[model samples]
Target chain A: MPVAIGLEGSANKLGVGIILHPPHQTADPPSPHDSAHSDDEAFSTRTQKHTSPPVQILANLRHTYNSPPGTGFLPKDTAAHHRRWVVRLVKQAMKQAKVQLEDIDCICYTKGPGMGAPLGSVAIAARTLSQLWEKPLVGVNHCVGHIEMGRAITGADNPVVLYVSGGNTQVIAYSAQRYRIFGEALDIAVGNCLDRFARVLNIPNDPAPGYNIEQLAKKGKVLLELPYAVKGMDVSFSGILARVEEMARKLETSQTSGGGPWKDDESGQPITKEDLCFTLQETVYAMLVEITERAMAHVGASQVLVVGGVGCNERLQQMMGMMAAERGGSVFATDERFCIDNGIMIAHAGLIAWRMGFRTPLEESTFTQRFRTDEVLINWRD
Target chain B: MAQPPPQQPLRTLPPPFNTSAESFELIAQGAESLLYRTTFLSPAQPAALKVRPQKTWRHPTLDKRLTRQRVLAEARVLVKLSGEGIVAGGGGRKVKDPKKKNDGGGDNGGVGALRGLVPAVLALDWERGWLVTEWIDGVTVKLGIYQRDLAADEGVLRGLLGRIGRVVGLLHLAGVVHGDLTTSNMMLRPTRTPGTNADAMARAEEERGEVEVEGGLEGDIVLIDFGLATQSVSDEDRAVDLYVLERAFGSTHPKEEGQFDEVLKAYGESMGKPGKVVLRRLEDVRMRGRKKSMLG
Candidate 1:
């Protein structure tokens, strides 16, 4: 078995995880229709014919930098938070994993497509550890990490992937050894739109802005009119975001002036803040689901695997499940542990690449702020 | 909370069509709509019918809004495009001008020369969510290019690509943007027969030889599926349309990807000045794929 320790601080969250991959086994082709088996069983059986064993998460831990209400985390503060927590988190992860320095095969860290400062902090930490421990360094793509981890956890073989997070929104499918993007958000990401909207409402970002929005949306009964902008397979949310923010400002102004509450046209009832949240969520999620369905039809794939931070929302999952079931397929999702950004995914995905003889030299270990998901060559997959 | 019904959940025709004795031949099933081949008006007139079924998965109100909006949008774009005329070339039968009576007698020379380049809208009921258009007889540009003899000369293929570009330029010139552009959406309609009388002509063409080789890089490029199209004169919209087609063509026809520039070349020449600006904007659009990569 090869053990790898992954350090992830691409954004506000600082995560350190240790993973071990068992030795290769005899090849066993998994049936695509087989979902009766447990996740672990399915994980073990489904591979690209290399018979790669199921991943073992030795340790996974995270510490998020939560900004105050109505404020988003700044890159500088988030980077400082990661810098302060990186060493401690790595030490704790190693101790929790109960592995010695000599037992580690390699060190992994997120390479690109993230906040520059945070990515640099993690890379510096990974580089320092690699030099101290005399282990090779494996650079992993942040998006690819989420995808591989979702596949490992759910065992959804060759399904279309809808990766939604604060930074990214793409509908991807595997083809010709690359995860080709079929559709995506043309402007700001779906999560970013939700987060900014939450800020306008001064929603607490305790667990997450998106999470709070989902909760408030549960009580909202009226679906307010919002601009529906879906062009072909691509969607634009900046327009919708601007419109919602304007509505929020108007609502605030009316309340401060002691004007009558914004009443529902039919019910003649006051529209609460929850109604705005509900409308935003419904409109955006519907756009996401529609594009996802279009991709499914284009590629003729039945199964769908949703990953990233926004994947944790119950309503989004429920909506996706309905769409998948309509196509005679099911949705595969993980809990917050794996759904949100974390280190284990990086470790798991990196180790797979490392085993395939892929390594990032120190000279090429530099990170980028604009690395695309499709740029990564998934040679390990068929 | 509850799951939606599974795929192929007993689809039913909408309204008056459901009561008609005429048989509806299922042509294609897209994500948002089902396409059927059915006769309309007269027994001999063949038409392409697009039905946007109600998605039970969506909220009832949202579903109704989308169905009505899309159906109406498509009908409006088609009607507008059909009104503008392009120079009809090649050996195809002349497009029967619907506005001929409105023009008051004799040919207004080249007026509506490109009338048949897009199928004329026969009828549509937005509330019921279905559209019918005069059927164009022939194969899709996708299959036409796919069936080409690889060993044959590339000249004919390039010519076909140039024509595709020219037609797209004309579409943009008409102040419309085809939201989804792919070889699949462009049809290689046989030009020799009467365009309206598609039923008998299609059969006659098929009997001549393999439909693919019989035309062999010959025919007018007729655009179809206006479900996602919009009325926009912006260069950004036009460039994006070309970009979508470029990406789709690359993925679908990797072998002929290098020749896609022929389409753009023709597009630029056909649309004159505006087309050149759109082509410039296409470079920026290409730099940013579907979305620009930012913070993780």
Candidate 2:
């Protein structure tokens, strides 16, 4: 077995994980190896049939920096928080995995598409570990990490990926050697929208604001009308966020008046915070599912894989499953351990590349905040 | 994952379609609508019928709202383009007035009016998601480009490309953006003589495959498929629209991709002042790429 450790601090979360890829069983014949330039041909050949070996997760750990209620985490503070906990998490992960210095093959870290400061902080930690352990370094695209980990956990091959997190929302699929983006949020991300709305309602920052909003939404009864801005396969959430924030203000002001509940003008019924949460979830999830379906129809793909923090929401999973079922397909997702930002995905994806003889030199191990999912050449996948 | 079973045949056609179902021949099945080739009022006149089927997955209210909104939006753009002094009339004369044809027969009006750049909307039913328009008799620009030898017919190809640019320019000038712009969405309507017999017109369309390579390119570029179109006057939106076309041309016609500059040049000339600004913005858009960076 080949083992690798990954470090991730793209946003406010700092995670460390160790993973192992067991050698293929000798009973099954090995697949043919081809040159990277023939990736399209390789993909077509594998599309007929391909199976991946099981991956063992030795240890996975994360520490999130949550801001106070009514506020959001700043890049500077989040970066400082990551720098403080990354070392401890890495040490604990190694101890938990019962691994030695010689057992580790390479050190992997998120290279970007996130806050510059946080990404840089994690890169520095990864660089130090690479030198201390005298191992090669592999720079991983954060979004790719989420996707690769999701696939490994769910066993979905060549599924369309809907990656939604606080920083990004994109519909991606493998074509040639890249995970081409088919659609995406034109403005604010879905998770960011939910998190900011939670701020307006002063939701607790304990666990996660998105998770809290999901719980509250389950108790909601009325489905208030919200702007549904889906243009082609792309969507915009800024308008929805602004409108919901205004509604939250009205609810607060009306509640202050003799402690009465805010009532709708037309129906004259009380509207609770739960109603707001419900409306936001229903509207946004619908948009997400619609775009995902469009992409699926475009590529003629039957399987869909949901990744990132928003993928952890049960409501989103259920809605996605329903949409997939209607298409006579299925949806693949993972629990928080793999769906949310975690180092295991980075380690897993990077290990795959490393096995294919890919490595990031010490000098080129720098991180970028503007890396695109399609920019990375996926040498590991056919 | 398994492939979805073949869709079941529709149980019954909606209101206006119920009586005309037998006459309609299914042509294409799109994501949002089913396109059929049929006749309008009489058997001699051919028409294109677009039926936006209701999606079972969506809420009835949302589905109805989207269907109605899109049907109206497409109709509005087509009507505006086909109206007097617009693209159909060449920006000066009334389409309904025969005597005023000479005045409209100039740089902008002459080619557009005579060419029939857009199919005239004959009828529409927004509530039922049905829009019928005069059927265009021509081959798709994709086929035209593929059939024609670029090296031997470079001049004609450039002219056709330029006209396409002009048509798209007129569309953007009218504050409308064809969200999806591809070679496949454009038709090369064969030119017709004033006294040409109906047989000759049909023959020209039928002989497109055999004559295209030898006869050189001939026809007006008519844009179609407005399912994703939007009414927008912003330079950013206009630039994105052109960018989409530019990408389509690159991928679909890589052999003649270098000739695309002619398209942009003609597009800029048709756009004038606003077009110039949009062309400038296109540079920035191209540099950053169409979609925004994935980072927060």
Candidate 3:
């Protein structure tokens, strides 16, 4: 059995995970019904009968940097933060997993769909480690890990995946061939939009005002009717962003223009932060769920998996759950352990590649802040 | 104890961004492709390396003329810019302590000279298509050198200019000209601490005559990114260099208004005969730039 260690540092979080698996363990893998070479032996053999057993929880640890949302997107800090934590996190995870460093099989790290800095750190660490230890290296897709973990937990044969996070928000569907992007946010991710809107509301992310907004939304009524734009499976939030800024201005209590309206300018605004928060929650999550619902209708699939940091949002989960119930489909939302970014997802995706004999040579260790997902042809046979 | 034995090997190394890169390992991705910090694998430390994927080189029918040669040319021009302090004072204060002076500087950091530019042709093996070179350390004046106090004093700046003049003179002497002379090419580094009177020291001294290259302690400057650099005898080529520098100074260090005139003064004091030719055309280029800025 070849051992695989995982490192996920696409964004601010530096997550490390290790998995020891019997080589080529999967007996039943997703069929290559989506690709053109459906009848090929190599393609067929790639699909296996045995899945890596559920008991294969290796070592996993995630460390996050306190970067201000929207602006914490610095490449240098991402690299520096990863450098600070890679060795320590790996050692800690190894200790927790009760495994020695020498016994590791290969190193796997996120390849792309991230800022340049953090991705570079993980790549550098893995390149050095693989060379020193004489182990193979594997680069994993940041998005695939989320979907893989979704399938591992939910057992969704085929489903609509809503990849909603800080940098990406897309309606995704995996055919027998490949993951097809059905619709995507035109500008920023849903969570990013919400975070920016929250900033306008003067919400601090010390404890992550995302949770605060959820709590506050529970106590207030939706007085402001905001724009709810969903086109087919795609959605637009720029109008929502502009309208909210206007509402913040009109309400006068918006506390914009650096300081709030004084006694002379105070008009006793109609909407409070609480009301705005409630309406925001109602609007954004509804847009996401509606888009996912439309994607489901287009794909004719019954299951949905919500991944990324926003997957942990209870409001999003509840709304998704309600939509799933109405459509007679199931929605799989990751727990906090899996949410908020972690290395286990990368490791999970890595385990699949390791089983398929995908390995990096000693001479190759680099990070692409923007590597393509579909470029590396998946050897779909498990 | 701080210095390792000359023979000790490095513990870690830079990685290749792509799997196919052969010579230089991809250290990080740049605006275009993966930046590879190469591994010399010898007793000496390897300079920086970057890998631009071969796939991106595939141009449609429209852009056949723009080639890898263009990339090398751009780097060469940048190297020249660094030498002139148009990028920043070479090996001076800005690079030494970059966290000083943030009162009201309107500059983007990392607008400095090439930290190192020896142009070592390790091997003509760019199979992976990368332009590997030394990574300069000093941040740019755009970063607000005052924010980090990275500005070198007048003595250091003079040392920087005298050295820079000789470099620009060498380029003209070598028959090559830098098309772009923006200060972003400048490398501002900290000077070694002086004995005294450092407080009253300014960056640019009042130049009235020929450069006094005393003590033979000339500063270091490296030009980079020679995309537009071309061998030239025409007055237009050299004038463009001064023009670019003037624009860079006006934009980057806005507080130092008319500072471009001071740089030309220093440049004139340094270049001698050809310097006068460049100076005569500098005014023409300035008027053209002003007209373009207004029209745009």
Candidate 1 lDDT over A1-382, as tens digits, reads: 6888988888888889888776552121122233232344334423333243356678889999999999999999999999999888998998888888988888999997889999999999999998898889999999999999888777788888999999899888887777777777877889899989999999998899999999999999888888888776778899999999998998888788878788878778777899899989888888888888877766667889999999999988898899887677788888888889999889988888888778888877888788778788888777
Q: Candidate 3, residue B187: CA error in Å?
A: 65
TM-score for the A-chain in each candidate structure: 0.93, 0.92, 0.84
What digit string (tens of lDDT, one per residue) describes model 2 on residues A284-325?
988898878766765567799999999999988988897787
The runs of at least 3 residues in candidate 2 whose Cα sits more than 4 Å from the true structure, single-residue gaps closed, are A24-53, A258-262, B1-12, B18-29, B37-40, B43-46, B84-115, B134-164, B182-220, B243-263, B283-296
The TM-score leader among the candidates is: 1
Candidate 2 C-alpha error for residue B47, in Å: 3.9
Docking quality (DockQ) for each candidate = 0.30, 0.23, 0.01
Pick out the ten consecutive residues of candidate 3 chain A with the lowest summed lDDT.
A34-43
Provide the lowest-lDDT 10-residue window in model 2 chain A. Answer: A27-36
User: Which model is ahead, 2 or 3, in terms of TM-score?
Assistant: 2
Between the candidate structures 1 and 3, which one is better when assessed by lDDT?
1
Candidate 1 C-alpha lDDT tens digits along B16-93:
888898888776666677778899988899998889887766767778788877776676667656654233341112
lDDT of 2 at A377: 83
Where model 1 places Cα greater than 4 Å from the true spot, the runs are A25-53, B1-7, B84-114, B144-148, B190-218, B251-258, B288-293
Please provide, for model 3 over B118-188, each residue's C-alpha lDDT reduced to its tens digit, 9 standing for 90 to 100: 23333222233445555444433333223433343545344444444544654554456665444434444
Q: What are the iRMS values of all candidates?
A: 5.5, 4.8, 24.8
DockQ of 1: 0.30
